[model samples]
Target: MTETHVPEKLKAPVLGAVITVSDRCSRGEAEDRSGPLALARLAEFGVEVAHPVVVPDDIDYIRSALQEALDAGARVIVTTGGTGITPRDNTPEATEPFIALSLDGLAQQIRLAGLAATPLATLSRGLVGVSARGDRGALIVNAPGSTGGVEDALAIIGPLIGHILGQLSGRTHEVESADE
Candidate 1:
């Protein structure tokens, strides 16, 4: 597998978490493929990923999972599933309340990249943003449930994790200088 390069400025491995939002998976009637894929992808970028959690496609459950990840010290949390147009697709809505700064460009980039693979990507309502709760907030992103969707989202964010985290921890100047 082709691995995304971890930026040199990243002095340490970043902590990450993955949440799979699918009723069937949560009910144990179906396997959760997206969550594992997300975890592996995050690990490929040198992220220390926490064990993934599976949740039903409910806003409350999704929100709780987000809080759980945050409480567990996850610096980046990726929720795979519930990003489609279906009635159960509530990842974006669940994640919105936690966002202190919206990363519209990153969200758009994921969609734009996905469009190259499938036109249905346009229907995805995934979101990307930062949840500024403590001295350092976690970066939260909502990705579709499909394996392809998870790949697309990770491919876009993998290389930028360090820089984004740096910005979150008030190291914007240092991160910027490294880019120069």
Candidate 2:
């Protein structure tokens, strides 16, 4: 079979994971549609994604899922769900502790792009940030539970993953001055 061409400039197969945070899905009362969708989307960007995981909306459960991904060497972890304004939405709260640096622009871009489709996008409290591990850190982001939100986020993240990863690994195209 012919290989699917990735639209991004990823230098390597990025190790990534997808977490679906939903109380119903975790309890098997609902199917995890978003997690699979997220994995497929990341694959389209040439990301080497791990098996999708599902967790409840509880902060501890969400954090455990994220921690597991990080421990497994995932360089990027995109969480689906738990970003709305509802009380059960806890992905952002769980994720904040891991963020050493916030990528506010990227997060804002997701919301802005989403606004073109629906005003409710403004209600999504998703965030993008990198861990404190510096060169060994991972880019963690929370995408709204809906498939459209995941698509919107990937649209912004896909093209930039290479550069973001590069920056995290201390790779840059900037030329140094001789004065240094």
Best by TM-score: 2
For residues 1-180, what per-residue lDDT tens digits would candidate 1 score against the true structure?
334444544677878899999999999999899889999988877788867899999999999999988888889899999999888899999999989999999999999989999999989999999999444699898988999999999999888887788777776442233335
- Show model 1 residue runs off by greater than 4 Å: 1-9, 133-135, 173-180
Give the lDDT of residue 163 in candidate 2: 71
What lDDT would each prediction earn against the true structure? 0.87, 0.88
Native-to-model Cα distance after best TM-score fit, residue 6 in candidate 2, in Å: 14
Q: What TM-score, to 2 decimals, does candidate 1 have?
A: 0.89
Off by over 4 Å in 2: 1-8, 175-180
Instruction: List pairs with backbone clashes in candidate 2.
Output: none
* Candidate 2 lDDT over residue span 1-180, tens digit each: 334434337767879999999999999999888899889988987788867899999999999988998898888899999999899999999999988899999999999989999999999999999985456789998999998999999999877777777777876565445566
Enumerate residue pairs that collide in model 1.
none
Q: Looking at candidate 1, what is the lDDT of residue 5?
A: 43
Worst 10-residue lDDT window, candidate 2: 1-10
